[model samples]
Target: MWEKNGIKKNKAQNYKCTDCKKQFQHEYLYWGADINIKRQIIKMLVHGSGVTDIAKVLSVSKGCVIRTLVKTGTQVNLKSSKKYYHKVQIDELHSFVGKKEKKVWTVRRAIIYAYDAETDEIIAVTAGKRSKKQVKDLFKRLNDLTIDWFCTDNWKAFKEVLPYERHLIGKQFTKTIEGVNTSLRNSCKRLNRRTTARAAPKFLKESL
Candidate 1:
């Protein structure tokens, strides 16, 4: 199935017959078209690499990096398992896009999710205000699954939404979810409000 096609005008080697007579290239003059590069992009995003950092490291353009992030983004799910988790941790990570006309801007942009403690897999996620609605919506995603109990910090939304008997409200049980928050904060530049705000005063101002 390996049939060689002549090099393109860009001087990149071309091949065919591997994908139903479709023209293919082992290497493309066009940057960021490689499967390996895309995989590395995902890996770097998970490991706390910013867009510019990924673009520089992978020798791709920033636009390509941003596009990859928008299309594939990052998957927080740790493992693929069909088994239901008995103990699930729910938590939120607070971050803001930019300063608002008033305070309480961070509340407008937050991420809440459910994480399986035993399997280390993210079960469900929701973005926006960390309110009862968002928390309820996050739980809705796992409605088909069997969840014995939930663990969360002293968030009023949890108290309102979750069953009192099936919920464990404490810092200890929520450690895993909290760790996820930290990792996301470290990985995603959008979550590092203070760092980006402080570091890029000029850029931030210009954007605003």
Candidate 2:
């Protein structure tokens, strides 16, 4: 059944099974570098290797790595019954596109901060461009029915966009959203790099 290259080879002779009396020919099936390659890819991802880096090192396409990771990663339910965070902090930050070329414009970014009141655990983060319309859209998407206290800085945009549930504006209250920014920067090295934003936006969104 084994070949010189360690692959299974097709058998030349046919044989009959004793119990079933079925005639069949033995064939050799092979498992080659593909399995080993997948294992290596998973290992590199565990070691904090970026998808592009893994693709480059493995000489495989980025799509392959992404598909494998997505297939293997845990999937969570999107629908949430809980509406409105007890203490939600909201803020925006700028991420640039070009560096070496002098004419670089900043991307106004927004993030929704949700934390569990009792556990103080960060629950969710929604990021997008900064705009009053966008902020309002985010709140609509959140579908939070019960927000106890929504905190932000003196950003008129938030004031214009957010609903009248319970909003607070003051200095030092936007720290939670700032902390989310810090987490995003630390976790995604690609965002911190001074390169053009060439990576696929879909993949970047998924990675986030």
Candidate 3:
């Protein structure tokens, strides 16, 4: 697709599935995202572009981008399952669903992530409601790592789930992961508090 003003959009082409006798677009290498829209969406996400900007430039609907991100994004894992780290930090970021009514935000969700502090590499990331179970699940994933220190904020779940000796709770030691929290808010529209681009839990989870 290309615009009348000579602005090129996606170079995507379509094909039919031989077995299913169905047509599909080749841009996303999957269904839904057509005309190379997936590539554009990914690039926009990397550059910290908001969802509205991405949809406008790529010539796709906001809903289309969100659905595509959730479908394909969830299938790919960022962290290698076999790798382990030494020192790590854990933190949570917040996002909300729906709109504020009567001067109140509803359906709040938390985006929790872990990172290797020494290497400054992310280990794990997920989105869910703020609860003890969320913290437990995140810690459980890091069980494979050869962890020495686990730094976090003064969240009570961190104290309960993590080993007393290994867990380190203080702002000083958690600067790196804290910065990541800021970066997440800056990069993704759903993570921004004041933005109209809210997200459902499934979409937030995959987006993270």
Q: Where does candidate 1 clash, by residue pair?
A: 48-187
Ranked by TM-score from best down, the candidates are 3, 1, 2
Q: Which tens-of-lDDT digit does each residue in 1-208 have in candidate 3?
A: 3222222245555466666655555346333346356777877777777667777667678777766556554465556444656668888876544454422211234667788766767787665667788888788777676788888999898899889998888999899887887777777665665765455689787885
TM-scores, one per candidate:
0.55, 0.48, 0.63
How many steric clashes between backbone atoms does each model show? Answer: 1, 3, 0
> What's the CA RMSD of model 2 in angstroms?
12.1
Query: RMSD of each candidate?
Result: 7.3, 12.1, 10.8
Point out where model 3 deviates above 4 Å.
1-35, 80-84, 95-108, 187-208
List model 2 lDDT by residue over 1-208, tens digit each.
3222222245444455666665444441322125566678778876657778888778887777766665544232235445555676666554454554532212224444445434445544445555677677556755645667777788788788776668888757766666666666555543343543465689786885
lDDT of 3 at 88: 85
Identify the candidate with maximal TM-score: 3
Q: Give the TM-score of candidate 3.
A: 0.63
- Total backbone clashes of model 1? 1
- Model 1 scores a C-alpha lDDT of 0.75
Q: Write the per-residue lDDT of candidate 1 for residues 1-208, one digit (tens) a residue.
A: 8688898888777888776786777767765887678889989877777777788778999888767765663343333365567899998877544464433423245677788867777878776665799888877777778888999999899999988989999999898888888877776764665563334579796895
| Candidate 1 vs 3: which has more lDDT | 1
